[model samples]
Target: MSDTQPATSQTAAVRFEDFGLSADILRALADQGYIHPTPIQAEAIPIVLQGRDVMGAAQTGTGKTAGFSLPIIQRLLAHASTSASPARHPVRALILTPTRELADQVADNVKAYSRHTPLRSAVVFGGVDMAPQTVALRAGVEILIATPGRLLDHVQQKTLNLSQTQILVLDEADRMLDMGFLPDLQRIINLLPKQRQNLMFSATFSPDIKKLAGSFLQNPVTIEVARSNATADNVTQVLYKVEEEAKKDAVTHIIRERGLKQVIVFSNTKIGASRLSRHLEKEGIKASAIHGDKTQAERMTALEAFKQGTIEVLVATDVAARGLDIAELPCVINYDLPYNAEDYVHRIGRTGRAGASGDAISLFTDKESRQLADIEKLIKHNISRLQLSGFVPARSMDRRPRYEESEERGVQAGRGSQYGRGAYGSRKEKVDPWFLKPYEPSAPTTKADDNGGAPQSSSKPQKAKVAALLGGVPKR
Candidate 1:
């Protein structure tokens, strides 16, 4: 018993003011200068405000945050409080994300939207000191945004309570499953009251996501702004085939040739992300890497720097880059094509966001043909393959041998005119012409002996034999 609402082209005619949202919410939207809602927001905001369980599926950057955040704020404002007592603000709405970045991003959105209202909000995640989080939790907040593990940690420590939480939102449910957060989700869900509103949103609607939604949501509305596993229409997708060893150089060449000022390069592995970041830095690009190996502080600093234009390139892994909402990101380069075809969709989704034109460029070697094909099949469209013209795969000059360096310097200083005998010493030696002649045996001397059959074998002189018995034998 679920309602299916397909997004329409007419959604463009809808405005934020028509949603019947509160003046506070509308004022906050106006503050951010958001008058019109994206397709997902147009469809989801009204339904979410109705307090019905919702299952939203949309492309990554089509205003999913505001779709749920605004209504949740409007609904929670009914119970909003200005009391000074900590008990006045109990966790009423809980938003769970798969990654810390997403949690932090969602928390920022919720805080901004709720700024004009009395609804207090807070976010908690791992990778940093929990002292600050514990303090915030003790201070009390109505809206709590957290990753499942961190939320459970706070619950276990008794610093937070969710028994009175009224609404539960699972953002990026598919990613949570990929991250193996099902058990955690179950545990956290068990801790909440069963009579709460459930809202789930994901980029793709896989079977596992559907099953999870069936189990968790009660007669929810299914909202799909685009087809499942669909790439954005505005994104220009292209691929460049390169040799394995030349992939790094290909990235540098592409960036330099295109003069791209701001872009995110997605790597499949943390090590690959870091390596690409270092390579770009060496190539004189302002680049930084964000991955699980980096501390939370370092990741945040890099993200902030990239957003502020201090870093031109933000190379990141899938997990680290999940839920990143960068405004007007012009391009995304896939340093390594993702193994999972669905990830390819998410990778490219980083660009072409919010109806903006973007380029999704990927560099793949021969070995990634299967991955490429799978991605094509999943997206139901062929990505244009282009040759990387003028890409000569830079060779490392630092690896030159010592002798070569000295020889080159000598030649430059007029020490030698040629590479062979002058720069390096002569490599040739003198040889005798006699030793070069073919092998020949001398003729045997056979003179006047006409009767000699074999020329008497050419014998040499022989010494006389000694007596068999000496002194005593003579007397005998």
Candidate 2:
């Protein structure tokens, strides 16, 4: 099947059934309550089924996982011979993710999609015992979803093999680069077969991502569902300027005032996430923090509690929350602005998933104005300004100009002095030490003709002349 164009108003809508999927796979979709294909899915499925490489850019809630997984599953099933058994191959497809959470989520989706087929899949990640992963590989699974670190560990141990992999997916390729996993990704790509299909998906394609794609992909089809760095149209963004000290109070106030039932609050540091969660809990709002430091059990427990409404808020670092799938989540709070501008899209993507309307709130301190500016530039939209009642900013009272704005005055004061202002009223001129010395030459001393006698030392010490030369030597 060839790739199909996006549906127009007069055209009939394309359903998953129109893609020639197996009966069992369609049954699984029905069980999951999926009737229509998302935009990414509608465009990517046909091209992928045609055995072509696809590079897709879509926001978080666009059902991109199914867009790639469903077609891969159907193609694999179509190629499977009736007499062949499912356990014959140890692996035929490999999916690499940046974080363990995303790996597990993708693995779950692949498993769910391939349920009716006679294929098996497993997920491998760090922060757990490797013996189980080894056992699963030995049992001969067909698909493997893994993180770069743990997957490399298995490859080095000679326990897992990728010689037979037919499809390769780098989900969230931008995040992989952000976590400094480019070298690992390259190593894994080197291990896979050269003829395999490649699919790279991300919320935003940065310059580094473009460079990576040039190296990995062949002549491929590029599918972009929205503009670059653009957030979902359904999400409403707002910013609150507050002091650094009173940020927690402001967040708590907003939650109480709005009566938000479920929310995800993002923090930059692990300690900050934990501290904020504790403060919220003390203020009678149930919350928990999830980060890389937490054990697998602890992370899973917190996620389950939050999903079940036992916890009202989740305080998470960027790495722990990427690729988290929560249905009907309404609010996302940037308790701390992300260090990277691209992460703003992924963070807010957790809400407004599956075509649902949502809201994102960011708390910006006076010091974080530049970060906020960068975010605005990336998103290409102005965030609505908001102020809380009874909250007065302390730094707002200071009329001191920003350092960047005072560059001219700073330069006019001095060239090499530490203090901006000189001790005298005028600027001080720097003095060179070599300029204070007199010149000397290495000319031979003339002796009297009558006496070839040795020259006697002068009674009075003659003052030594300092050399006057540019290259540190006297010219005769």
Query: Quick one: best lDDT, which candidate?
Result: 1
Q: For model 2, what is the C-alpha lDDT against the true structure?
A: 0.83
TM-score of the candidate numbered 2? 0.79
Best by TM-score: 1
- Alpha-carbon RMSD to native, per candidate: 14.8, 14.8
Model 1: lDDT equals 0.86
Candidate 2 deviant stretches above 4 angstroms: 1-12, 79-87, 390-476
lDDT of each: 0.86, 0.83
True-vs-predicted CA distance for residue 22, candidate 2, Å:
1.2
Runs in model 1 with CA error above 4 Å?
1-10, 395-476
- lDDT per residue, candidate 1, 91-209, as tens digits? 99999999898999999998888889988999999998989999988888999999999888888899998989999999999999988899999999999999999999999999999
TM-score of each: 0.82, 0.79
- Steric overlap count per candidate: 0, 0
